[model samples]
Target: MEDYLEKIYELMHEKGYARVSDIASSLDVQPSSVTKMLQKLDENHYVTYEKYRGILLTARGQRLGKLMKERHHMLEEFLRMLGVSEETIHKDVEGIEHHVSPHTLQCLQALVLFFDDHPESLNDLHAYTEQFEMGSPTDTEGKSV
Candidate 1:
């Protein structure tokens, strides 16, 4: 499953090899579930699963996993820029990354790049957000009252 692939990718990044127990713990699932998913992944050629040994991703699997991780990071960064909290970013990104299209992701990447080159814009945006949070009323035409 996609969750398995994501966990394997994360574990591989954190630690070299991904043990079944590690994967189970990361996903908060039982080892039996991890074993079953590993078997399926092995059959699909995404990973090499031994009975007791750890799993290793194949070249194709690794590439796909890396891409997913990158997209997750991009989503997190984009959400942070929108004033989403760090705690919320992890949950929000996890939920949206799989559903967002490549075109949307590209747009988000472009926005990130644009802000990176123009940090002042972020400050202005933050000030505007603060104005709304401070209970400043806006007129019908959308101008601050």
Candidate 2:
């Protein structure tokens, strides 16, 4: 439901409004499924949903959607810094976003801040990783190549 709300918010931001079909398309789900979820969100006071019409996020929905989007962005940034492939970053962010704790998110945010403030350190780590990856294989005990 957080994912749905986030997508709805994003669509609304991009297009000034979000219809069930639009949300469904963005989420890659059937419109009927979107309808059902929207109805539930409406009942929960997260959104104002109307049949054959657009959706609007409530204040609570807005807050949650913003947080969800931020969390996704943070995870993606962290993964990119680690040299994760785009496909893996996308998949891993989706898998981990919902389950990540607030404390962990804070830690990641701090790590991002640190890296941003210390580009030289980040560059050194990247260089070391590149060299490590290019080096020969290690033994079973991980002693030598």
Candidate 3:
């Protein structure tokens, strides 16, 4: 359900249409998988599909997809700010965004906006992380007993 919605969102962003082949290729799944999911989404009123054509997200579906994409983008930006590697951000955000609570998402969004407004704050993050040893429980100021 969410997977199909997310795939459709990605396909729409990449191309104008949500073709079965496009969704399958993007998800690395079979065309049969995409067809089955599309049928379900159509039944659920999330999309409109026609045989041999492609699927179009309904207004509800489009809104949901856009929200999910925003969350993913926010999580990716937050992870990057934490010094996570670019190579890992895509997969990491994919896994984490779905499970993160709304409060966490809002916090992440705020952090992204904050850093965007103050790029120098990133240097502070680096310094804060460097202050803590691997197993230490020191405070933010890095003072250890």
Identify the leading candidate in terms of TM-score.
Answer: 2
Report clash pairs, candidate 3.
Answer: none
Instruction: Give one digit per residue, the lDDT tens place, for model 2 in 4-97.
Output: 9889888878999988778888889999999999999999999998887678899999988888888889899999988999989989999888
lDDT values for all models: 0.86, 0.87, 0.83
What does candidate 2 score on TM? 0.87
**Cα TM-score of candidate 3:** 0.85
List TM-score per model, in order. 0.85, 0.87, 0.85
Colliding residue pairs in candidate 2 = none
Task: List runs of model 1 lying over 4 Å from the truth.
Answer: 135-145
Better lDDT candidate (1, 2): 2
Q: How many pairs of residues collide in model 1?
A: 0
Q: Give the clash count for each candidate.
A: 0, 0, 0
Model 1 lDDT tens row, 48-91: 88997678999877977888888877888888988999888889
Ranking by lDDT: 2, 1, 3
- How big is the positional error of residue 56 in model 3, measured in Å on the Cα after superposition? 0.8
Which window of 10 residues has the lowest lDDT sum in candidate 1? 136-145
